[model samples]
Every structure is written in structure tokens, then in C-alpha cells.
Target chain A: MVKTHIVKFVGTSNFKMFSNHMATIVRLAAQQQQQQKRGMATLKAISIRLKSVKNIQKITQSMKMVSAAKYNRAERDLKQARPLGVGTKEFYEQAEIQAPPEDEKKLVIAITSDRGLCGAVHTGVSRNIRDALLADPKERENTKIICVGEKSRAILSRLFANNILFVASEVGRKPPTFNDAAKVANEILNSGYSFGSGRIVYNRFKSVVSYAVDQLPLFDKNAVVSAPKLSVYDSLDENVIQSYLEFSLASLLFYSMKEGACSEQSSRMTAMDNASKNAGEMIDKLTLTFNRTRQAVITRELIEIISGAAALD
Target chain B: MSAWRQAGLNYINYSQIAARVVRQALKADLRSEALKRDEVNVKFTQWKDGKPASKYIVFILFYLVVL
Candidate 1:
């Protein structure tokens, strides 16, 4: 009878253990189901984001190709135009000629890309312009801004609506012609807008990863003379100087446009590259979660089978 | 001029050198701060409706934990 009682107590304890194991299995199964559903949802979302990123990458890649083609041509023109522009400035210095004091209004021409996928290209140029303008207290009252791209125009208008004089659109995509730049320049010059000082703010492309914000002086030829001792016109004829100045202004405009294009292409490429990499990473993470949830479900099933076998024994 | 002369030379005080280095470091810090002023003013406009790109990773981590 004592032995029988001991066996009964042992059986009751085993039964309780079995019930606890079953409850744990139920709870685990429910948790696994929830986890699996969440993992699937995450995977689906990641796939969708990946597709969108791919489309963006293709668009940015095309833009880079187009910009590259335009940049090459612009760079050639700039190379030929830079020396002439320099020579023209030297002539003005040697001649000791001042642009008529009537043209005393300062003009700032800020160039940026029309479309944005380019990382920080537009922002950097805009920031440089803002900083330069704010640096000089006198510039605030007399300064007029001429924006080249639509993006730049929009930003400048929002920030300084009262100061923007004009905006040139759709010029960034194509090889900017001297005629187009001259037209913009002529309008500013003719509008009773004194060219007291003019500056062209744009990027100078050094490589795929680096660019510089270069401020080219548009007015006051003497500003170009960094040293006081150097002779301004020790090397050129008066006629050459006149021709060179015209060509140089045209070239400066062209170079800025080219450099801006190059910077835009590089920036877009980098942005897209990052986007694609991020998409890949997301897909990987989702895949990992999906696998883990799937394994947990299997583990719960294994636990149920083992518990059932033990009960049969 | 080699070993014998080198051994007889007076020991140099490093405090003067340390002071010069400290002054140079301070000057560099000032210059960098001036340059940083131009960079810091440019504010990045954030997307109003959606989560920021940086938050996406954190959201994924939370999702994984729940799963």
C-alpha cells in the first residue's frame, strides 16, 4: 500500500510536469506565429523599398551619364577661356580703369543644379552664398542675386525674396552657350543695374569625391591682383586685352556651368550608391528575421513531438 | 664629433617646446572654430511627413525583436 501511494504521488508530479510543458509549447507556438507574421511583413516592406531604390538608382545613373557628356564639352571650352579672362583683368588693372562708379550695385550669381538627387551639391553652393553675403554687412543693402537653376532660384526666393533680380532656368542640362550667359549678363547690365561688383558662385570639380566652392570675382579688376608689386600688363597689347576680357567673362561663365555639372553628376552617383547599399542591407536583415521566425516555429513543433512521446511512454 | 661630442652636450629643456606646442594647438582650435561657423549655419531641412532615414534602421531592429 505504501509503495502504491508513492507511485501515485510520482504519477501526479509527472502529470503536472506534462501540463506545464504543454502550456509552454502553446505559448511558444503563439509567440512564434506572431513573430513569423511580423517577419513576413518586414520582408515585404524591405522588398518594396528595394524596388524603389533600384528605380531611383537607374534615374540617377542616367543623369550622371548626361552630365558627364555635357561636362566634357564645357571643360574644353573653359580650358581655352580661362587665360583670356585672366589677361583681360590684367589689362583693366594696367589701364587703371575703373568700371563707372554709377554701376555700384553688387550682384551675386549663384549657380546650382536643376534636379536634386545630387547629395549636398546644391546645399553647399547655397550655404557658401549665404555665408559670403552675411559676412559683409554692407553687402546686405546693395546686393542683388541672380540664380541659375530652378532649385537655386526656389531656395533663394524662399530665403531672400526681395533681393533676387532674375533666375535662369533649364540652362544646367545643356552645354551652356556664351550667348545665353551674355544675354543674362546684358540684361543685368542694361537694367540700370550698375555692375559695381559681380561674383559667380559655383563648384570647382576636382574628382568624383571632392569639389570646392570657388568665388570668382566679377567686378573690380584690381581685386584679382593679390600682390601690389606685380605689373598688371607687362605682357599683352591693348586690343588683345579687350578681346581677352570678353572671352574670359564668357569662359568664366562656361567653366562654372561645367564644374557645376560635374559636381552634380558625382553627387548623384554617390547618393544613389548609398541608397542601393542601404536597400541591400535592409533586404539582408529582413531575410535573416524571416529565417529566425521559421526556425522558432520548427523548434516549437519539435518540443510538442517530444512531449507527446514522453506521455506515451 | 660623433659619440664623444654628443655625450658632452647639455641636456635640452622640453618645457619650452611643450609651451610652444600648446600655444600652436590653441591657435589651431581658434582657426577651426572660425571655419566651423560657416559650416554649422547651413541647416538640413527634414521631411515633415515621414520618418527620417536614420530611424529606418532602428525601426528594423525593433521589428526584429518583436519577431
Candidate 2:
């Protein structure tokens, strides 16, 4: 009789790196086992692989739970923030404020988060900016990028480093505040780039498992003041307009950050859930292979013992 | 001049200070809930490598600790 015991894996700070390597190894092992090559050594290897996969499954399960908790808060917050964003945008639309078409200079603020392991949340935002950059050479030359998180900066910096004005890191580590948005908005206002117009590229939350990269238009003080319908509003002093621009920018940033956070949490929950499921399937396959190999070894030994006895007879 | 600017705060700090005041002035029932939104403990670091060695390691540690 063969007894199998699970070997405990001592996790380190570099566990993510270790788990990534284990995932690839498991894939290769699964492929090798598919060829039906069975032996005692292979049985031992399968047991070890099974242990690691089980450990990873446990981690993924816990990660899924954590993400679920975060998702609940994020979704709630997003509900409140959505109306604020919509109202701001509606004002801009009703006023007919748009960037002057001939103004070539543009700023692109890419809103993402520092953390990853969420399914393509950061990548979606970066790809939107990348597509815009690639679409027009002239626009690319005039465009300046302000990345809101480290993940997008890491990706976009590879090819468009020159285009990036500055990057804001440490985002999405905690729930964002209005104060945080104000800080980011103030940075943009003071960044000395003096861009004619801009658009914020962000991932809009659609559903629990899905998100779409969306763009929100940004206008400078000049564009806002130059709108044809501005004359309809009375008592609009310079101070009020300036204050509104600043406040509106912060509110828009706050709203978009909330949406991105909600999207990220939901996507992470889904990603971890899928990872746990895949690990379960892998463990099942490895267990099947282990049992078959153990039986094969036992039968081979029995055949040798019986043949030796027959020779003696 | 605003109280924040009088204390020599920059525009960024000034705006944040003002926001805090507004959150503080919410009604008793609403203030507690609104105050929750004021807490941000995010830490920032500059990345020198592709993997963001220092900050990424800390993030992973925190993630594991939470689990």
C-alpha cells in the first residue's frame, strides 16, 4: 500500500514570483503526463506538483474572498460617484464647451492603478492611449501623458517615455478620497505643459466581469471661457470660473478613480476565482496520474515476485 | 485669503484642506459616513527596475498578510 502526504510549501515574500514559475511548470507537467508515460519517479513528481497546486488554490481562494469584500465597497462607492461625474459632463455638454479643432496640443491622462493581478484593468487604459498615439503622428508629437498609476507608467514608458509628463503612483492602494483627486488635479494644473485640451482615458465599470475603456473630455480654462453659450450665464466672474474649473477637474478625477477601482476589484475577484478553478482541475488530473502510477508499480512488483516463485517450482 | 493659504499651503494643499472642512461640516448622521472617505493611507515610491523591486515587494507582503 502506498501512502501519499502533502508536502508543506514555505511561502516567501517572493511568493508571487515562485507561484508564477510553479504555474508554468504545472502546465508543462500536465502536457508531459498527457503522453501516458508512467513510472515511480513520475509518481513522486506528480505528488509534489499536486501539493504546490493545492497550496496555490488555497491562496487564490483567499484572494478571491478579499477581492469580493473590496468589490462590495467599491461598487457602493461607484454608485454615488457616477451621478457626480455625469452631472459635471452634462454641464460641459450643455455649455457646448469643446477643444478648438485646430489646437494640436493635447494632454492624455491615463487612469490606472498601481496594483495588478486584476484582468487587464491597467492594460485597457494603456492600450487606449497607445492606440491614440499610434493613430496620428502629429497628435502623438503634441500629446503629453499623465499616468495616474505605476502599472500604466511601467507599460507606457517603454515606448512613449518622452510623451509622459509625469506619473502619479501609490493609487488604488486604498480607497481614493476627494483630497486625493484634488492633489492630482492640482498637479495637472501646475505641470507647466499648458496643453490646449485633454481627455482622461479610464476603464469604465460595466458589469461584475466586464469593463470598457472610456474617454472623458477635458478642457482648459480658455476653451471653457470661449464657449459661444457662455454669454447666457450672468454674474460669472473670473474667480468663479477659475474655481469651477479646478473643482470640476477634481470631481471628474474622483469619479473616474472610483469607477476604475470598482472595475479592478470585480475583475480581480473573477481572475482569482478562475485561477482557483484551474488549480482544482490540475490537482484532479495529477491525482489521477499519481494513482495510476502507484498501481502500475505495485503490479510490476507482484509480477516479478510471481515469476521468481514459478522458476523455483 | 483662505485659511489654508494663509498658513503658507500651496494650491494643492489648500484644496485638500478645504475638502476636509466640507466633509467635517456634514450633518451628524452623514458626517460619520463622509469622514470614512477622508482616510487615505497610500504610500508612494519610485521604481528603478522593471519589476519595481522595493514597492512591489511591499505590496505583495501586504497582500499576503491580508490573506
Give the proportion of true interface contacts each model preserves, from 0 to 1. 0.00, 0.24
List of chain B TM-scores, one per candidate = 0.23, 0.52
Q: Tens-digit lDDT track for model 2 on B1-67?
A: 5555467555556667777899888899999988887876444333332223366688899999999
Question: Candidate 1 overall Cα lDDT vs. reference?
Answer: 0.56
lDDT of 1 at A174: 55
* TM-score attained by model 1: 0.57
Candidate-wise lDDT, in order:
0.56, 0.78
Candidate 1 lDDT by residue in tens digits, A1-313:
2123223422422223233443454455446547767433343433443344345435544655765565566566556655644564565455555444555578888878577656778878888778877787677667878777777866766666667776666655555554455545444444465555688898877777788888666754333333243355476444334334444555566567766777776666665555445435444554565566567767878999999999999
Tens-place lDDT per residue, model 2, A139-251, is 88899888888899889988787787777888988878777777788777766678778998888999998989998888888888999888777888765676677778888
Residue pairs with colliding backbones in model 2 are none
Candidate 2, residue A58: CA error in Å? 0.6
Candidate 2 chain B lowest-lDDT run of ten = B44-53
iRMS of every model, one decimal?
22.2, 4.6
